[model samples]
Target: MSRQKMLARALIVFALLGACGTGARLAAAGEFVAEARTIAELKAVFGQVESRTVVPARARIGGTIREIGISEGREVKEGEVIARVVDDKLTFELNAADAKIAALQSQLDNARTEFDRAQQLLARGIASQSRLDQAKTQFDVIVSQVAAAQADKAVIEQRTREGAILAPATGRVLTVPVTLGSVVLAGEEIARIASGQYYLRLSLPERHATEIKEGGTVLIGQRGLSPVASGGSAAARQARIAKVYPEIADGRVIADVEVADIGDYFVNERTLVWIPVGERKVIAIPPAAVTTRHGVDYVRVATPDGPLDVAVVLGETFQDGGGPRLEILTGLRPGDRIVMPDVAP
Candidate 1:
């Protein structure tokens, strides 16, 4: 064939391919739509799920640890004994005090007897007044010594019982820092526990500091969770912003979201948290019609020429009765018709 003829054939093939490409886009017109809706306002953020209350079990009296009653990850009830400290030293102190009291008691008895004798003799005009006064004074001094020894014994006895560290609250023991035979000081931490309830802690940009307040709703969920089959499980996921920290650190505002069934989550586990910041009109599109490719989100929009793949910036993905929906922050407008492509968006 002549060179001109060959060029003509190549042009015809190029035109055919363009025509077919247009046909595919035109066929997508039935699958998508652009509509103005009050999509639930939300901001998706990554956060750590942690126990809202963590209590430390500490040794109240200095002693060597004698027994550890619970292991890590063990559930303990409030007031349950977590460990025992050897009370041998405390026992020795109490015994010494008791011995001192016994020895002093004998002296006190002798003094009291002499005071009685002096009193009897004085009444009969046989004892000097100085002798009676000295006897009475000696008796009183001995009595005070005995009382002081008894008080010392009482404190040692109380400390002996307190050697057994008890759980501060119902919780799962997270760690046991002291082992059996380890000597510990008074007020030293022995174990750390996660108090039963938990919350999700997250940081938002400091710019949102003024907007976060207590009682604000936050949706919390882990990755790979499908829509729950039961309505009860769905309701359990609702979280509220229980506390908004007053101070900003590193350009972020801290907030705590309280949830009821957070015990299943491990401490510091990362999960998604969606806070409802504010609401406004948005072009909401169903997730089924949206396509993601190479880190970009796209949806097929039916243009005047034909269906076109338009890149969209999705704000926050929200769920409702229908299913997951995307909040289109850019690239679409109200009254624009769209469709799901036969292959993909």
Candidate 2:
């Protein structure tokens, strides 16, 4: 064949292949469907809830527990006498000091009388100078004895007051470690009390803790509690981040959150808490629609004729609700149709 004819045949084959590719692309377009992006009020991603154990109150003095004023699970006020120590030795010492004080008072009275008599005798020249001096000295000695006795009595009284055990603060009694009439040593734990005001102490990953601040809000939920199955009603309680502990515990930052007036509801010894960060209202789509290609996040949006890949600015996830949806910060709107597999938008 001639060279011009051969070139003509090659050009015709290329044209046919191009037309076939166009037809295939057009057919794929017909299978795509549009999906409407709904605008629903979504909750922001809040942190997790935490709890700690309540410690018991200990006794300040050692003796037989004479009384137990509070029962388990009962509320107690500050400075309330939770127990009493029967220190018979302390009581005997107190009685002895009182007797000595009375004796010293009588002696002081006698000394003053003697001093008055000696002064009268000297003025009348009926007593010698040596006798008057001796009388005065005796009076002074008795006065000193009375002062010492009074000081001893005061010390005994103070110790007597300390024998009564008082409540450290207002809280609910959890356990009675000592029974009535049981011998207790000084500084021994007599009872455990849970402070009515509860705080959540927990440790979080170092990276997550950086996003938290003192006085921020925290959400609490029971551990092993699933939000999707229960609709997150139990996880709705709010808490204030009271403090962030300075040191890291278990490789995580320790934080304390104060539950807002919900202490009464949480009667259990242990519970969980959650803390939330930044949140807003935005368009959300299922995670399945999100596709990652070459380290970039893309979602297929339903177009009139077919699905088109659109780049999305992603926000926090709302995983608590039934549907696991990603908040769309940008690139989507309400009422925009989205196509599911095998359907046209």
Best by TM-score: 1
Q: What is candidate 1's lDDT per residue for 49-69, written digit by digit as tens? A: 788688899999887998999
Encode model 2's per-residue lDDT on 246-292: one tens digit a residue.
Answer: 78767788777776554532344344444553444567766656667
Candidate 1, lDDT over the whole model = 0.80
Task: For model 1, state the Cα shift of residue 16 in Å.
Answer: 17
Candidate 1 TM-score, true structure as reference: 0.69
- Scored by CA lDDT, what does every candidate get? 0.80, 0.67
TM-score of each: 0.69, 0.60
Q: What is the lDDT of residue 209 in candidate 1?
A: 82
